[model samples]
Target: MSGISRRKFLTCTLVGAGATALSLKTTDAFASAKLEGYPDSMGVLVDLGRCVGCRSCEAACNREQHLPAPAQSFDDPSVFDQTFHNGQKRRTDEQAYTVVNRYEPTATDQPVYRKSQCNHCNEPACLTSCFVNAYTKTSEGAVIYNPNICVGCRNCMIACPFNMPAYSYSSATNPVIKKCIFCYDTRLKNGLPPACVEICPQQVMTFGHRKELIEIAHERIKARPDRYIDHLYGENEVGGTSWMYLAPAPFEEVGFDTTMNNEPIISNVKDFLGTVPMVLAIWPALFTGFHLLATRKHDIEQHGDDHSAHKEEEKKS
Candidate 1:
C-alpha cells in the first residue's frame, strides 16, 4: 500500500478498536452501576459580590463546628493581613472550615471578599481516590468523609483540585483530613441552611439545591451584569462543583485558581485507570506465547537426540 493509504488503514483500525472497547466497557459499567448518596442533600452558594468581609459566616461555622477559637477573633480585620509559610494568605484550616479572602480589584474602588471552602464537587476526587472508602457524596450534594475509615494516606488532600481538605497534622495519633461537611450531620440532615449561610448578615450565602443555585446565580448575573463577573467559577470546574460562585472581580484576583480545566479532576487520571485492565488481560497471554516460542526448539531437538541415542544403543545390544 502507498504510505498515505497505510497510515489511513492503521488509523481506522485503531479508532475502530478503541471505539468498540470503550462501548463494551461503558455498557458493563452502566449495567452494574447504582447511584450513591442522599438525593435531597442541601448546599450553600456564596455570592462574592455581596460579602462585606464581616466574617460572620466564619464565626458561625467556628461555633457550630466546635472548632477552637482563632488566635485573632473573627471580628479581627488583622486576620486579612496574616500570611502563611509561602507568603500566601491564611486559608481555611483544620480549625476553620471556611475562610474569606480579600481581593482588591483595580477596576473597583472597594475590595471584594471571596469565601473559600469545600467546593463539594459533583464527582468528588476525594471520594473516588480514597482507597479505604472513607468519603461519600450525599444526594443532597455534600461530599463528606468518615475519619474512622481514613488511613491518613492523604490521597484525598492530594486529589482535591480546590485544595479544600486540610489535615490535622499536629495530632500524631489521630491525624485526619478536615474540611466543611456542608453541616451534613446537623442542619443539612434536618433540611436547614448551614450555620455560615444562616448567619450571614449580608445574605451573601444562599443555601439550596445545587441545580437551583446555578439558576439563581445566573439570574443574579443577568439582573446586574455590570455588578458581577459574567462567569460562575465552579459551574464546570472539575466537572461541576456542588458549591458554585458568583464574583464581582475575576476569580483569579480573588485567590481562586483559574488554571483548572473544565474537565473533572478524575478525568485527568482516567488514562492511568484505562491501562490497568489492558495490562491485566493482555500480559498473561502475551508472556505465555513468548515463553512457548522461546522453549519449543530446545524441546524438539532434545527429543530427536534421545531417539537417535536409543537406536544406537539398541544396535549395539
Candidate 2:
C-alpha cells in the first residue's frame, strides 16, 4: 500500500479542515442565540443636517490619535473634490481613523456631509474572524484591537462589513490592523466623549447610551419630519452598531449601504467557527493513527520481501 508520512498527513489534514470549515452550514445554536449587545452600551448619534463639512472631527481625531500628518490641511475644502476610481469617496486608512464625506444627493437641496468610521458592531465580523483573539468588544461598546497579538494576516480587513479596518502596509518590520476604537483608551472608558465629538463646532454628533440615542434620533425625526429622513441608518444594520446616523437625505444616496441585512456578519459563519475547536482537538489523534498504520504497513512489506528471498534460497539448495 502507498504510505503517507506524518508530516504530509498533517499538512493535508489542516488544508482539508480549513476547506470544510468554510463550507459548513449554520448551526442551530448560533442561529437561535443571537447577540443583541449590552443593554447600556454607549453610542453616538450623528445628525447630518447639522454637519457643515468643516472636518473639525477629522482634525481632532488626528491630533488625539497622534497620527501622521495629512497631505492637505484639514481646513482645505479641495479635499472634498477627491474621488477614487468609480467615484468612491475617501475612506478610513492607517493615517486617518475618521473621515467626513461630502455627498450631494439630488433629493437634498444642500450637500450632506457624512462622517465615516468604524461602526463598532455589537458582533463584529473582524473579532470573530481572527483566530488569534486579537479583537475585543468592551462593555462600553468599543471594538478595540491589540497589535501585539495580531498575526498581520489581514483577515480583519476582509471580514469587516463596513471596510473600516486598515493595515499599516507602510511599516516594513511590523504591520498591524488599524481602526477606530471609539476612543476607548483615552476618553470613552473615562466617561468622556471622543475627541471628534467634543470638537464638532456644529454639534453634529450626540453621545449617550445607545438606547437613549435611539430615542433621541426618533424624537428628532418626529419633531422635524420635513428636515430629516425617517430612518436611522445604523440602528439595526448588521446587528446594530455603536454609532448610528440621522441623515437628511436617503441613506443610499449618502454612501450608506442600505441593502445590508439586520443579522450580524458572524451569524453567517458561526457553524464554521463552532467546529474549529473540535478540529483542533481531534485531528492530531486522527493523523497520528494514520502515521502508525502507514509505519506498520511498511514493516509488513519488508518482512514479506525477506520471506520470499528465503523461499528462493530453499528452492536453489
Candidate 3:
C-alpha cells in the first residue's frame, strides 16, 4: 500500500516467497534425511534403579565443565526438593548442564531419581532448526554447539523435545547456549566416559557403543523382568537417541513424555516444508498470467478510448 501498485505488490510477494523457499531447501534436506548415526558412535545407558540421588554426578559435571558455582551447593540435598514456576522440575540452565530430579512414584515407597541432560538424538532437531548451523552432531554421538557462529536465534531450544538447551542470559554480550555435549572436548573424543559416569558411585550409567548398549539394556531387562520395565526409553523415541534409559517404574511417572511417536520431530516439519518450494515455483507463473490478462484488458480499454476520440474528431472535421 506504500505507493506500490497491485502488480508490483504481487511481483514482490512472489519473489519473497521464492527466496524463502530457496533458503529452506538446505534445511529440508537435513530434516528429511534418514540419519542412522555413526556405526561406532558412543552412548550412555542410564539405569534409574541404580541412582541413589547422591548428587555426585552433578558435582563431577560442574567441576568438569568449569561452570559457575550455584546458589545451592551441589552437596546439598535441598536441591532435589526445588521446583521452578508452575511446579515444574528443575531443568538444565546456564549454570547447570545436568540436574538430578526426584520423582515419587505412587507404586513404590522409594523415590526415583532421574538425571536430566541432552539426549543427543541420532537425528537431532536442534541441528535441523539452527539456520546459522550453530549446532553440530558429532560422529562420536555428541550434539555440540558453536557459539562463535551462533546468531542467538534460540531455535534449537524450541526444536529440542527434551527441553535441554539453556541460554546464557547472564552475559549481556556474547551470550551462548549451554547444555551437555557428552564432554566431547575433554573425554568423549578421547574414548573416556563422561565425568558424571565415572564419578557416580552406584554405577547408574554405562558408557559403550550405542548398538552394544542396546543389546546390554535388553539383556538386563530380560534377566530381571520384575525389576525393570519392558520399554527402553529413547530406543525409538524421536528416531532414537544416543542416550537411553532403563527404569523400574513407568516412564511417565519419572517425567518422560509418553505421547511422542517414533518419528523424529523434524520429519513432519520437513513434509510441510517440502510443499513450500513447489507452491512458490507455481505461484510466480500463475500470477504472471493474471498480470498479463489485466494488462491486455487495460490496453484494449485505452484503444477503445482512442477510437472514440478519433470518431469525435472526424465528426467535428
Candidate 4:
C-alpha cells in the first residue's frame, strides 16, 4: 500500500484500540460524573471595535511559540491581501498560531479587522470526536493536545466546527496537529494573559473569566449600540466558546460564520449516540429469537420421531 494509506490504516487501528480502552467501565465508579472545564476558567473577549489590525498579537505569538519567521514581517500590510486557492484569507497555521484579517464592511466607512484562532468550544467537537485520549479540555478552558499519543488521524480537524487544528504535514516521523492552546504552558498557567492579548496595543482583547467576559461584551454593546453588533458571536454557537467576539458589522460581513447553530456540537451527533444504546440493549434478544426460529423445524422433527417410537413401544407391549 501507499505510505499515506498505510499510515491511515495504522491510525484507524490505533483509534479503534483507544476507543475500546476508553469504553471499558471504571472499577472505581462514582455517583456523579463531573463535566469538563473549570467553573472559573478564564477566556478572552475580542472587541473588534478596538482592534487596529497592527498584528502585534501575531508577532508576539510568533515569538512566544518560537515559530519560524514569516516571509513578510508582521508590520507588512500586504498580508491582508493574501489569499489562498479558494480566494479565502489565510488563517492560523503551524508557523502562526494567530492571524488578523481585514474585512471591508459596506455599512461602515472604515475597514474592520478580525483575528482568527481556536474558539475553544465548551463542548469541543475535537474532544468528543477524538477516538484516542490525546486531547483534553482543561479547567482553565484551554483545549490542549498531547502530540505524543496523537495518531495523526486528523479526526479532530474534521470534527472541529471552526476548522482549527493545522497538521504538521512536512514532518515524516513526528508530524502532529498544531493549533492555539491559549498559551496554556507559559502564560495561562502563571495567571498571565495570553501572549497575543498581552501584546495587543489596541487593548482589543480582554482576558478574564468567560462568564464575566460575556457580560462585559454585552455591556459594551449596550453602551455603544452604534459602535458594536447587537449579538456576541460565541454566546450560543456550539454551546458557547471560550473565545468570544464583538463585531461592528454583522459577523457574516467580517467573515464570522453567522450560520453556525446555537446547539452544542455534540447535539448534532446525538442521533448516532441514541442508536448505540438501542443496539446494545436489543441485539442479543433479536439475534437469539432469530436463532430459535431457525431451529424450530429441526426441533419439531425430533419431537415427532420420539412420539412415533413411543407408539411402537406401546404396540409391542
Candidate 5:
C-alpha cells in the first residue's frame, strides 16, 4: 500500500464530510411526511365567490401580527392600485402578512378579489433552500421562520414559487425574510382560527383541517356548480397548500398563477438530495479504509528499518 500525504487525507475527509452534510440537508428538506400531508394539518379555504373585497382580513392580519402600520390604511381601497416592483400590485410585505388583490374577471361586472400570502406549502421551497434550516413545516401546517439562525441569504425569497417572502431592506440593524406564519404562535397552537379567518364577516374563508377543507370545498362546488369553477385551486397545486381557493371564475382570470404544476417545488432539488444517502453510506468506509491502508504501510516501513538496524548492531557485537 502507498502512504497517503497529510494534505490528501484531509482533503478526502473534508470532501466526504461536506458532501454528507449537504446531502443530508437536501434529503431532510425534501423528505416531508409521506407527501399526503401532516396528520390533522390545519388550513384555510378561501371562497372567492363570497368575498366582497372588504379588506377586513388584511386589517385582522395586520393587527394579529403586530406589524408596522402601512402607508395606506387597511380601510383604503386605493391600495388595490398601489404598484410595486415589476409593475405588479402590492404583495405581502413587512407590514402585512396577507393582502387581498382585486381583479375584474371577464364577463362579470362585479370585481373578483383574491387573497395573497404564504401558501404554507406541504413541501415548502423556502424550507428546502435554507442551508441553515431556519424554516420549518409544523404539524399544524404552518411554514415558520427563525430569524436568529438566519444567514440572511435571501435564498428563501428566491426559492418560493409564489414570491411570498419579503425582506426588511430599511432595517440596517437586523433583517430577515418575513411571510405569513399561519398564526401559529398566537392561535394555531391553541386550536383557534387565524385572525383573518375569525374576522371575515362575509365568511369568505373557512378554517379547518386540510383534508376536511378539501372535502368541504368539493362539496360546495358540487352543491352549486353554477356559482364556482369546476377546479379547486391549491388542492394539489405544487403538492398542496394549507391555504386553498374556490373561485367563481377561472383561476387565472381571478389573479391566480395557473402555470404551476401539480408537483411539489422541492421536486426541483430532490435529484441532488437523492445523492445524500449514497455519500453517507460510502464516504466513511472509503476514507477510513484508505487511512488504515496508508497507516499500515507506514508501520511496516518503520518496522523493517528497525529490524535492519538491529541486525547490523548484532553483527558488530
Candidate 6:
C-alpha cells in the first residue's frame, strides 16, 4: 500500500482463492522518486460504470464548499444535454469543481457518463509550475490551493494537463484559480470521506489510502473483467494520481487524453530547475579557469619573444 513494487513472487489471495494478485507496477523512464504521497495518503477510486449521472455529488460538493448558488438547481437533469460546438460536453470550471459528462462510444450502446475533476497527481504540475507556489500536495494526498499566495498568476491552469483548474475571470481585484480541492479543509482533514464521495448514492466512488485503492482497483478488475476495460485511468498517469478510475469503455472514448507520457509533469521541470544550482555554482569557476590559462599562455609567448630580442642584442654586441 506504500506504492513500493515488490520484486519477490509471493502468492496472495485478493478477490478469491481462484483469483491471484498480479504483480504489475508501472515503470517510468525517469526512474525517479516515488511520490506515494503520505504513508496514509487518502484517495478516491471512481467506478465510472456505476455512476448514474444523478449529480448528487455535485450538489453535495456545492453545499460542503459553500459555493455560490448555481444557476441550475440540483434536481435539474437538463444539464446532461449540455454540449459544445466541438461536441465536447461541459468541464470543471469556477462554477463547478466536479461535472458529469455524457459519452456514447457506440451508436447502439448506452451512454456512459464520466465525472471530471482534479486528479491530484502525486507529482502535480500545478504545484511545480506555480510561479508563486500556490498549490500544495498534502501528506493526505489532497492537492490543495492557497488563495493568499496565489497572486492570480494562473500558471497552474496552464500546467495542468488535466485542464482541471480555472481562473475566476469575473473577480477583478482578488481573482484566483479555482478547482476541486478533494474537500481537504472540511472533511478529509477530519479523517472523513469527502462530501461528494459521501453523497454519491450509487456508491460509484470510494475514498481510502492511495496505494490501497490501486490494489482495490485491480481486484475489481479481476473480479469482473468483462465489466471493466482492463485499463486503470489514473494508475500511471502523470506518475499516478490520488483520484483513479475504472471505466467500462476506453478512457479515450470518455474524453480522456491517452497519449500523455508516463513521466510526471514536473519531472522535466525538475530537470531544468535542478540545473540552475549546478550551472550557477560550476560554470563561473570553469570559464574563469579557462580564461586564466589563456592569459598565462599569452604571457609566456610574450616573455619568449622578449628573451629572443635580448639574445639578438647580445649577438650584435
Best candidate (score: lDDT): 2
Sort all candidates by lDDT, best to worst: 2, 3, 5, 4, 6, 1
Tell me each candidate's TM-score: 0.80, 0.79, 0.79, 0.81, 0.79, 0.82
Model 4's TM-score against the true structure: 0.81
Per-residue C-alpha lDDT of model 3 across residues 1-317, encoded as one tens digit per residue = 36557876677677667766765775667565776778988999999999999989889999999999988877788978887899998999998999999999876679999998999999899988999998888999999998899887899999999999999999898888889999999999999999999999999999999999999999999999998989899999999999999998999999999887888888878767776776687667767865765586577779999999999999999
Off by over 4 Å in 4: 1-38, 293-317
Which has the higher TM-score value, candidate number 2 or candidate number 4?
A: 4
lDDT of 4 by residue, 191-234 (tens): 98999999898899999999899899989988999998799998
Whole-model lDDT values for every prediction:
0.81, 0.89, 0.88, 0.84, 0.87, 0.81
Compared with the true structure, what per-residue lDDT tens digits does model 1 show for residues 84-109? 88888778789999998887877677
Q: Write the per-residue lDDT of candidate 2 for residues 28-97, one digit (tens) a residue.
A: 5566788888987999999989999999999999999999999999999898899998988999999999
Q: Give the Å error, residue 55, model 5.
A: 0.8
> Which candidate number would show the highest TM-score if scored against the true structure?
6
Candidate 5, after superposition: displacement of residue 258 in Å?
A: 1.1
- RMSD (CA, angstroms), candidate 1: 6.4
lDDT of 6 by residue, 1-317 (tens): 44322421121222222221111111232234656566788899999989888999889988988888888997788988888878668888788898888788762177788888899898899998888877889888899989888998878888999999988888989999999999999988899999999989999999999888999999999999888989888889888889999989888887789998888887766655655665676556655654655465577679989999999999999
Query: Which structure is stronger by TM-score: 1 or 6?
Result: 6
